[model samples]
Target: MDPNAQPDRLSDLPDVLLVLIMSFLSFKERAQTNFLSKRWESLYLETRDLSFKESDFLTASVYANPIRWLKARADFVGYVRRLVDRIRDQPIETFGISISYPKPYLELIESLMAFAVQKRVKSLVLDFSNLVWRTYNDVNIEKLVVKIPQSVYDLTSLESLEVCACKDFDPSKLSKLGKLRSVSFGWMELTDLPPLLETSRLESLTMKECLVHDLEKISSVHLREVAIYNCDFYFMCIFNLPRVDIFKYRGDIMSFGFDQMNTIISEVELDFGAAEKKNDVSYDSYGIEAGMICEFLNNLLDEGRRTATTLTVCPFLLKVIPRSEHPHFLRPMKTKHLVLKTKLHPKEFNGIRLLLLTCPYLETLTIDLLPPSPIATASSYAGIDPQTYWMQNMSYWCLWEALTTVIVKNFVGGATELNIVKCMLRSVGERLERVELHMPFDLDESRKTFALAKSEMLQRSSMNVKVVVHNS
Candidate 1:
């Protein structure tokens, strides 16, 4: 009976609802839907989101044949022009364009952006990573640097803007786009960022692999999250941010200062990876990198104690701190969550102990174990047994009564790992409610280690500490 019945129920839907459904389809699918019926064709034309990507034009054949690639690129440009023309008058809500950077395509891209602005698009994303090419000689081809057009800056309705692999990104060019809330710039060059922070109503800002110079301070009242990753800057300071709750930094900070901070931050992640050389307090100049790191840690901990409930410290950052200053620098804090990213070796065991002793009120502890570096393992024991080391440090061990949960990820259950677990079990006492050990799935020995760890914990028989072990 259904064979003869036409599927007109979908076709009978209202034009507005049909267009809404079409919005979720890809550009190619939406174009194909035009052949379904005249009603579908009309609704497809009214789709709100316009995404034109380079993959839509060329196939894998273009990679091996240069001539075909050229022709496909040209065809893509022509198609993009036609689509932009059709959508120029329509009310667009979001616009995204990803294309290889060619000199001839710049004007067309700008025209599309101008059209989107005129149509009051709310979100704009321009990605040009495809233009990057590597030669056989291992040299990178020069990238096309497109200065964002003024139309983008003037889009009053724009709420989000993300531009990748651009140059000369001056935030001062931005007009008062009152609705702008989120901005991300990647692989760009920046001179000053104050104007952008002071002018925009942004809630989040992220800069990745950008070249920044003389960025003095960022003072934003509306910002809730800030992430700076692999960026180069001479000097930078977060002067004032009353609402920021999450902050992450992953690059070299020549000189960092937090002049003002919110009283209650949810998380703070610090990754001092390979950025020590660029840091303003250089080891070569001061000849006391450890002291400098200790000073920096003190400042960070002081500020974090007032607000941050969770603190994450990378392994590289820990390597910079002097072993002697560990206890002093890691004084007692109100932080409830502490995460240590390190190789669980005998040498690092002391640092872990110092952390537990310092953060007396820590409710949750997470240890992310990385593979033991050759240097760390070779020098970790240094003829000192881990058990003996822990025995010597037992006098400094403070009762971690508030600690209710412990998570050890990437657990391999080596003697060092077992020793650390035993020490924690002893220190946490009967109040410990749960201990979770996440072992690597690829290692066959993990199951055996889990069994041993479970037995050892059960032998304590002090309290019903739930020992949960699972494959990571």
Candidate 2:
């Protein structure tokens, strides 16, 4: 047989690996691939991941009456239900659904989750943010969050779930997923999150824009890493997680049992810029959590005997408090990897250098422009003209370049930003070896500057270097 010959009867790939590959595909793509042969048609149904995206709907668009759109949505959903209902054996791992234009309102989802329950889905992500915003004139944004059908909670095998841009997802629904290891909830009307406190195995959690009444509920013994945005961590004593390492969040951490943590955590990551964008109208340019994380870091260093391996911080709207507020304050850090990322407002840049001075053993240092994100869109469109379009872009570079390794992402290659980045690579880092500049676009001048920076760095740096240029 020729090496490039097509195989017979789907003998080309192993079933488990086939399922794994299948897991990464969209539901429509999976369905289309199934049509390639009989073996594949039934293979996807047996695979662990299943997704239904309303964007994949094949029905004709309706321009005038809402009833026509509803009917088409119903028909499209019925097609999905019929196909899933016939699967010989249920897939037992991942199940997902995204409704881009939900009309005839989720009666289809009621049936879909029932199928998911039968499939025993282990990881589930459901997005209902699309409420026919396109084509229909009767779209009501508020209806999207009113109350997700209660059947969503029936997925008992779910281990990781991300529900975005849709609502009425009472956290109580999570209690049914006994084995959940990670849970992320966003844009829901979550006033309190006591419901999530019970998930002991949760390793990574991201909460956004919810009213968190009790922060103490999140002190899970097994939570190893956490990222929160726009949500309130009401303040609770954080204890030692022998295993927990990375932590990131924004908004308010109102209270703390800082005195209780009994062990050294290997890493701390704090990010708050997007939140400043999200709560623009109510933007406390200096968030309460900004100081809280700094204090948390200093407190942990005070108690920890072991040096941190990685420390990442973003002080977006908030800066160091006045010395009078904490007269005896000392920066807490002794890490090999130190990252300071932000769009620096002059006021916010005050105490950053002092904090870096404490990380004497630091080996890897990165000073990044504020990262890009899909979530930040809400703020720019929030109807409030941003008080300062260039609010935090100006930064002091001389202080940042002193660290060993420098990596910059989202470098727009603006003269000022590039100068700041290049100055870091050439100046302070005598041992700088790996310099990565990932640009989103290809400009010949940028590449030339990169090479020039590399040459300049080689003359001064005391280490062998590999300069990587990643252009996207």
Candidate 3:
């Protein structure tokens, strides 16, 4: 030992403090601390959060060779069993295990889940999807799935649960989970979700790529956030919820009962994939599908119904809304903030104008210009002119008094962007306070175009407005 050696201040910390810091690190990262000093070799064993993934033990070369893959699987199984045995008596707050292949390790996984229940774990995550199998399309979906064991229902202390790539999961035993507050499921088939909602005091729920059949209605007094993405649904409805704050849905158009959401939601997102032209229904024809969509949007702000403070929508809704002169076709929106994710095409200009007139109290607006998808080129009404469309007789109370800020994302200095900006400036230039343009990459031409437009805008309108540009 050298007399002039610097003192090991970091390693000299107390064991309680060191264990508190190690609790935030992953299992693999905490293992590296064993090499720091002899004292740290056994300090990480006291951590209360244990998360393990099988991929952490295998290399790329081992995945490419069949013989090496078999040996690596055996080694991973042994490692997990030995590690869990060492910490069997330690109380854990979280227990997460991700296995790529679980067919041959059913008993082992059952023992691990039983261990979690005995340790009074608060959060659990069970993931069984294979990475290589999914990326290379080597195995069927059913071959990689596993069913939840009965021992999972004994986790009365669980507050959060996440299960992925599971099938035929009988949710009848979920009544025992009275302490659950949040739940998420993916790539699964479920029926009658009311049992879980009715039994537990759930606050947040999310589901994706699932097949739900014969669901009557979703009603939870304690729920605050709900998201359902790309799922096949049968007989699903949104019933009485008084405490919900945010709602998000993304999928094909379907009949959803929308007259019962009786709360003031903070935000709502409706993203229908690419905009596709329905051959059966024209823009003037109020067909069954088109009528259903219009009715749903109308109910968002109707009397004794739900209303959102912020609304986000895709281009499909703009293209499918019926262009009727009847007042009942579209209702006045109560949203204060509106976000539109679109390609800024000419055909959508009329819809944008209609929305501006409807939202009487809107204060801020955002237009996120998305890249054109492959199917967007097949739009039927692509020949409309923006200049003629925007130059019409209109009465917008928001533009005169309420609206102040406007933001444009992914700006590329296109003709459509210039025309829209000019139209906005003409309508509310005196009252507008700030305008922001966010560009994708560095482009000097875009900055120059904005500079010229800013100069002309100030010359024509009031000098109270501020224009700014940002590059990403």
Which number leads on lDDT?
A: 3
- Span of ten consecutive residues with least summed lDDT in model 2: 373-382
Count clashing residue pairs per candidate. 1, 1, 0
Please tell me which model should have the higher TM-score, number 2 or number 3: 3
lDDT of 2 by residue, 384-440 (tens): 222333333434433444355667655544443444445455455445567666554
In terms of lDDT, which candidate is stronger, 1 or 3? 3
Off by over 4 Å in 1: 1-92, 99-104, 129-143, 236-238, 276-287, 301-305, 324-328, 345-347, 371-398, 411-419, 439-463, 469-472
Q: Residue 227 lDDT in model 2? A: 71
For residues 1-472, write the lDDT of model 3, one tens digit per residue.
Answer: 9999999887778999999999888666776787887788788678888888777667788899989999989987897898899987787999988887788998888788888888888999887767754221243556744777777866788898888776567655675688888888766677768888776688888887677777767777888888887776776565556677888887766556654464688998987652243244555554444455566666655532557889888776665554544444667777888898877666566667666777777788888888852113323355676545555544344354777888878766555665566566677757788878777674477555764564455434546777667767
- List of clashing residue pairs for candidate 1: 254-280
When sorted by lDDT, best at the front, the candidate numbers are: 3, 1, 2
Assess the local accuracy of residue 112 in candidate 3 as a C-alpha lDDT between 0 and 100: 82
**Which 10-residue window of candidate 1 scores lowest in summed lDDT?**
132-141
lDDT of each: 0.69, 0.58, 0.71
Question: How does candidate 3 score on lDDT?
Answer: 0.71
